[model samples]
Target: MTGKLYGVSVGPGDPELITLKGLKAIQSADVVAFPAGKNGKPGMAESIAQTYLQPHQEKLPLELPYVQDPDALTTAWAVATDQLYEHLSRDRRVVFISEGDVSFYSTFTYLMLTLRARDTAIEIQTIPGVCSPLAAAAELGLPLTIWAEKLAVLPLLHNLAELETALDWAETVVLMKVNRYYPQVWQILRSRQLLQNSSVVVRATSNQQKIYADLTNLADLSLSYFSVLIVRRSQQWFNSS
Candidate 1:
């Protein structure tokens, strides 16, 4: 009997944000695995779940590099899948913890896909947790969307035209992983006079979390990889607060 694989979302940053079911899965698992951090530091998922993990549980760090190279990604996923299969073949329950929701831009999705492709008999389950957009909204004390408000969540901006299109249609726009394209984004928002209605939240819910409610003078602000930018077409809600 092959052991089951649990892809648990540990929330954005705060350990307490983890759901009861997710916490239970982590504590009961025979092995706990998370993405390896950069420069030998603990990854965001590991940092959030560390306090709840048991000493007896084997910790595994799977290397899932941040890159756009298809071949490099495929190789890394294959190696990580094999590593998990080794323990799963012996019937050891393995829990792979992700920083945010396992379904939303998560590495766990790739890992799960690779595992299923490798072995059709593998059992897998995913537990949902807080994603960055929701966490950022909470930190900003604003509603992500109101009734009938159209919302668009975009990844890194590869083209400014896409941003223009989103702003034209969506009442609310969320830009994830906006660190690199922040200067460009700032310029666009500035041109459209949306700076006052825009906000930036970095490392939401973490100890080092930073919040910029008014983007009026943040054109040159440098942000980290975990930054999120929220642009609202209406400043009514923001101005009232």
Candidate 2:
């Protein structure tokens, strides 16, 4: 008989941010799984969940690469799918975690799709956790979206093209995955005179959390892919608060 597959979200780096429901899922799961880079030995996601994990059980690590190679991703997913499928056959409940909410641009989404196609009866459950966008709002003490202003969460897909488009109308724009393309994001915001008004947060809600409004010197900095940019139109608004 196939067992349950729980998708848990260990919010940011703060263990306390993990939901009580998520803890229960982890505690009862028979096998805990998380993705890693091809060379990442100990899964970063699993390591983050270690604080809430029981002492005796070791985490099951799945290695998936970040680069864009269709064949490689397919192969890696297949191998991982097989490993997870085997656990289900043994009736071992599995909880796979992502850094933030499991569904939001998480690797768990990829695995979920692959697993679903193969087994129609496998039960899948997801629990939401805190994300960096909200965390950035708290860290910088900024109102993300007030008076029912439109808010857009756009990934730094390729360049600042989408960001430029969003700035034209969005009252609050959260640009996620801004690490590799920091300079690109900064240039567009500065050109629009939105630099000082925005707040850049890396690793929000974690011990490594770094917040800065000084975008002038951010051209050379390297940030995690988990970084986020909270952009508001008015500079005086954040200043007054």
Candidate 3:
């Protein structure tokens, strides 16, 4: 009698943004689960969902070491799955929380894969939440993609060549983690004449939201890793020749 597992997305940072359905799922679960960062600190997802967690409910946290290396991530995921395996085998329901839509660049994906590989008997369900990127665009009142135009959502550390290619072919480009290579991204956008048409959103959907249309301050500004830069209808390719 294996238990059911839920991977719920809590939306971005604002607690009010959590969908009613996700909240109901978490509330009804027997145990709540979340992944902490490399330092073993509590996770943001758990913090956001804390208000809704019952006083008697159990919170299961999986410590995941933050590293880009895939091998290291795999190790952490396997270890974390162990923490939930036993309870799940007993038919105890478990809910794993993640920020934004669980499917989009969330750490929960790794654990989902691990459980599947280990043949965990628990049934898994994922509930969608508004992605920060989408909410960011909404804040700016800018359309991410219009009729028949493709959009690319890319993270920093993506190769410059691939970045350029996406910028070239796509009608709109959403660059996440732009803070990692702010200067480089700025230079690329400026050279391609797309800088003026883009908007940089920091702390999207939160009270401290910042939107910048000017690239003049972009080079000096320090953006959060959660930030996103949206380029819409940017057909300007200076050297399209």
Candidate 4:
């Protein structure tokens, strides 16, 4: 009998943010799998869920490298699929923990798809948690959306034109993976006179979290890979508070 696989989102960085169901899955699973951390350190997902892990549970760190090359990603996912299948085929309940919501730009999606491609009979379940944008909004004491406002969430802006397009139609815009594009993003917001209406949250909801509620003077700021930039088109959102 093959065991079932569970994909659990550990939340945006805070251990306390993990859902009860996600925590239970972590503690009760026979094996816990997470993306292997770089530089010999625990990954974000592992760190957040470590508090609930059992001593007897097997730990599997699958190396899911952060790269854009399709071939490289495919190879890594295939290897991870094999590693997960090894325990599942042996009737060991395996739980793969992911940082933030498992369905929202999380690496677990790729792993799950690869695993499914390997065996269609595999049983899988996913649990959602607080994504970064919502966590960032909470930290900023602002709402992500209100009334009928249109929201746009984008990942890694390949061109500044995309930002222009989002600002054109969306009432609220969230830019993920904003580490390298901070300067350009700042200029765009500044040009549109929306600097004061924008904010940046780094490592949201974590102990090391940093919030920049105003982007007026952050053009040269350096941010981590986990940073997120939120822009509200209506200045009333900022002025009201």
Number of the predicted model whose lDDT against the real structure is largest: 1
For model 2, the run of ten residues with the poorest summed lDDT: 36-45
lDDT tens readout by residue for model 1, 60-87: 9999999999999999999999999999
**Global CA lDDT computed for model 1:** 0.93
Clashing pairs in 4: none
> What do the candidate models score in CA lDDT, each in turn?
0.93, 0.80, 0.81, 0.92
TM-score of each: 0.97, 0.91, 0.90, 0.97
Error of 1 at 19 (Å): 0.3
| Model 3 CA lDDT for position 104 | 94
Clashing residue pair totals per candidate (backbone < 3 A): 0, 0, 0, 0
Compose the digit string of candidate 2's lDDT tens values, residues 147-232. 76888888655756788788887888888877777777888887988777777888888788888866766667788776888888
Ten consecutive residues with minimal summed lDDT in candidate 3?
232-241
lDDT of 3: 0.81
- The full ranking of all candidates by lDDT, starting with the best, is 1, 4, 3, 2
lDDT per residue as tens, model 4, 1-241: 5788999999999899999999888888999999999999999999888888889999999999999999999999999999999999999999999999999999888888888888899999999999999999999988899879999998989988999999999999999999989998999999999999999999999999999999998889999999999998886665666
List runs of model 1 lying over 4 Å from the truth: 237-241
